[model samples]
Target: MRRKQAGIALITAVITAALVAALAAWIAWRQQLWFFQLENQLDQGQARAIAYSGVQLARFTLRDDARNNQVDHLGEPWNVPIPAIPVEQGKVGGRLLEQQGRFNLNNLISNGVASDNDIAACRRLFELAGVPPQRVDALVDWLDADGETRPGGAEDAAYLALPQPYRAANQPLTDLASLVRVQGFDAETIARLTPFVSVLPPQTPINVNFAPPEVIAAIVPELALAEAQAVVSRRAGRHFASVGEFIAALPERVRGQLRPEALTVQSRYFISEVDAQFGRVTVRYAALLERNGPDFPRLLWMRRR
Candidate 1:
């Protein structure tokens, strides 16, 4: 009887030891997972902070440029991209882009009406990009306040007819991504046009000093793409100091057709992008800034991801 009792006791002790070992392993695993999660959160916080600091750096540079320079161009110091610099745990980098360098889509409509000159310019731009110029008509209807749709346009009714119904936004676009909501604009089309076009406040003129060859050609009627390329190539040696200088440099044939009022040598709007990475976490910050006269650039909007 004593032997039987001893054997039963040993079996119970062995099972208890096995349970204790399994519990210890589970606790260790849980603690390790918790540490990993906490580290990732810390890395994310650090990366975001570094990204914001980079934005302030851009703002300071733009403010200095406003005070010192009369014109914004590719040759200016503010146009240069900041090389990646090592931070406490990782690196950060940034760049400034002149928004006025691209054709402004908001300029297509003014005072609740479509501007013929702007429409013509956009048509030329679309043709140059090999996109259907008819897309412009749809864009116009999207911007115009009235419900009447143009031949190639879609209004509220058309959108409501979709399988997933929505309404047309009869207003100026706040960002380039809004183009996907407009008729005839797909991801591919918007991507193709992004290099040459922008969505900025109304009446914003194209900054000739930084505009691409396609934009230069579009704005200057009768100017061929090759001639526009030559114009851009010349800017490498010396940027245009004034609209007059840009116009005078154009081919004599197209000079007569150029609208000096539709172009500028100065930029009022700019985009700043900064990236920061820490550990396995990365963050990107983007901001739109507006500078007027000798004042510091104003932050219009910002996003971090």
Candidate 2:
């Protein structure tokens, strides 16, 4: 009887040991999953908040930087500066750009008309940047109010000669990407030119306080690259106090394109970013608050990374 009792006790002990081990393993697994879930939730919430805050910061920075988005914290203006990259899984950061600092799209045909000087300037700018003048000349022909192609430009005749079908953009460019559609305008070259030019209203010239080095060189033909760099460097963390003050920083030719009214201390666009880490996500927004008004920031672009 005593031997039988001993056997029963040993079996019971083995079952209890197995059950305890299984319970411990299950608890560890649950803890690990909970930890990860909590971390993911925190990151998501933070990213959403940071992206929202970025929009506000951009609006504020634009206003503080004379509506020039390139201004860094040091008060130095940038022409086509790269944005800050994201770090720390859940952190968010972004760079702001000002459209007015670039060559105005409307500059293509000023005041609903094209002028010889403007055409020459545009052609010269493309040439200096290594673009074929023939291509730019054709682009201008398409931009003109009439359908006639200018001399040295591509027209329907030229288009027909090409194997690939092509169409002229007879109307104004509604977006900045239209440049690649022009003949001889490749994506590589356009990407390089993006820093210097803009597709904004043609009547507006670049704001001196915000003009990138490329715009400075394009606007003021006489300006050496160093001279343009100097203008950006010497501002001592400040924007040009007036259009005249800004002109003084330019070469004689750049002065002609600028006007007193061209200076603006307001912001028209902004980029807000948010980063989250169930993976990563980034959202960008453009803010339009030309006047003092109350409105929640609106969404512009959303990207997940």
List TM-score per model, in order: 0.91, 0.59
Count of backbone clashes for each model? 0, 3
Q: Which stretches of model 2 miss by more than 4 angstroms?
A: 1-53, 60-91, 149-154, 159-166, 221-226, 236-238, 250-305
lDDT of 1 by residue, 150-239 (tens): 333446677878889777677889889889988789999998899999988888999998889999988888889999999999998998
> Which lDDT tens digits does candidate 2 get at residues 68-107?
3433323544223335455455445555555666666556
Lowest summed lDDT over 10 consecutive residues: which window, candidate 2? 285-294
lDDT of each: 0.88, 0.59
How far is each candidate from the true structure, as Cα RMSD in Å? 2.7, 8.8
Which residue pairs of candidate 2 clash?
106-201, 106-202, 107-202
The candidate scoring highest on lDDT is: 1
